[model samples]
Target: MTVVTKPKAQPRAFISLRSSVDFVVTSTTSEIIDRALGYLRAGFPVHFRGPAGTGKTTLALHIAAQLDRPVMLMVGDEQLTSSDLVGEQNGYRYRRVVDRYIHSVVKYEEDAVQNWVDNRLTTACREGFTLVYDEFTRSRPEANNVLLAALEERVLVLPTSNGANAYVKVHPDFRAIFTSNPQEYAGVHDAPDALSDRLVTMDLDYYDRPTEISITASNSGLDLAEVERVVDIVREFRDSGEYDQAPTLRACIMIARVSALQGIRPSLGDKRFVQICLDVLESKTAYTSKNRDRRTAQRKMLVQMIDHHMAHPLDAERV
Candidate 1:
């Protein structure tokens, strides 16, 4: 007779997310984050709901970091499923044993069994890791049905085939953060009311002008005055409702950074600077009408916007 010991399997590495160091935390941003943290620490999951460029996903990661736990990040997809959330039987694990009763004779036995793997959600629940599910509504609602009980009952019901461990007791330190675009946005699916009832949703809008300018200045390596000029034009364009898509703070930063790198000032006096502003802002509308000259009209409007903010040399003196 022979005896053997199974070696221990090493634990898999937990997922790591890069720090949100570049995330500009202004007064308004701080307030939103604090409120979301309050909800999360109180044993309720937090949801940041807003349109595109509203920083929902970024805010979710920021809040998850404050929980002081290892984080698991999940990007929602249309192909996700309940098994994808919990555990599923994968290929198989095989074992072989050889017995030598006498010097002249030997016998062999082999066994194989299905391997089960825990997906991100299940691992987060069992190990008490913070979960950041970005663009969760992009996943089909049926795929997310597994979350209902986990959020409400503090228990995760697993498939019976998982055998003795058919359910996971939600860890006391477990927390989940979710982000999603508005239901009207393309490729965004409507979340179920049952799941929505479990979350404390915070609807985010674009940062106010002061915050936008501050963020642009920090990210673009541009002076406050220059950033203000760029942000002002973008904000004006956003408010005018003259385009297919609204311009965002991202647009402001894009213009500011490129101009700064190229040694172009944000001034109407410089033709290159004027062209940069038009190029960054004009792409939003993309007019292709042969009948009417929408491009000419919008170009005229955008130039007027730039002239309002950057044409004045005195604006620099005030800054």
Candidate 2:
């Protein structure tokens, strides 16, 4: 009997494989980090569910950074094709092989495989890159059927000369992370139960006070006192049924950013600050009429809220 040995496989070319340890995970967003870490450890895909502007995409990016894998992101669209997720056979080229008009010339031509294949999902699977399918459910589910097998069986069926082909087995380190709005929201789909079952689902809502304040102050460059005051007003307004739609952390951050950009302090006395808050509330409430009147009346009430804040800056009481 004779024994034979095969050569070791070479590593695939990755975009970049370096992990960054610095990421801010406020209490409001800590669950995102925990869920991502859990999936990374358990070898499962994670589905982050939230309303728009809830930091789903940011959370996914933070996870990719922590895992030290290069991130590949694809925003789902209605016209997305399987070839868009995988690669396609670009057309071939032709050359004149010979010139026979005078019967005195000979020439040679050659055909070869295209040197490169577009590697969206393929590269991620092969090189263990972190893939973030942002707002994946926005696209029709039919467009993503091919992913079912690739995600479950860890096999990518690529097109080749012989019809369809299979590439290197999915690397053990590969991970899939998805973010999407809830199905009830506009432009989102109820993911097939089969696919949903395979993923670890985490429903994310608005951020809590401490976390919201921390994020606003740190990211928006607002003073801590001002951040707290803004968070209080937004949280109270949402809880008090003053608006049909709840204020998202995104809205708060936006308000803070706008205030900073305008060189305005977080003082409630600034009419412009009140107007900014009103604008955010209006945009968030446009989808529902349940509290339309209440939202409309909030403008009048904001002046009082600002006056109270100014008069009793040290009240230390929640609105």
Which of the numbered candidates is closest to the native, going by highest lDDT?
1
Question: Per-residue lDDT for 132-248 in model 1, tens only?
Answer: 889999999998989999998989988757557788999999999999988987788999999999999999999999999988888788888888889989999999999888898
Candidate 2: stretches off by over 4 Å = 1-23, 93-116, 159-168, 287-295, 307-311, 314-319
C-alpha lDDT values of all predictions: 0.86, 0.71
- Name the top TM-score candidate: 1
Provide the lDDT at 313 for model 1. 66
TM-scores, in order shown?
0.91, 0.80
Q: Write the per-residue lDDT of candidate 2 for residues 138-210, one digit (tens) a residue.
A: 7788767767777789877665654435454777788888888887877787787878888888888776788
Against the correct fold, how does model 1 do in TM-score? 0.91
How far is 237's C-alpha from truth in model 1 (Å)? 0.4
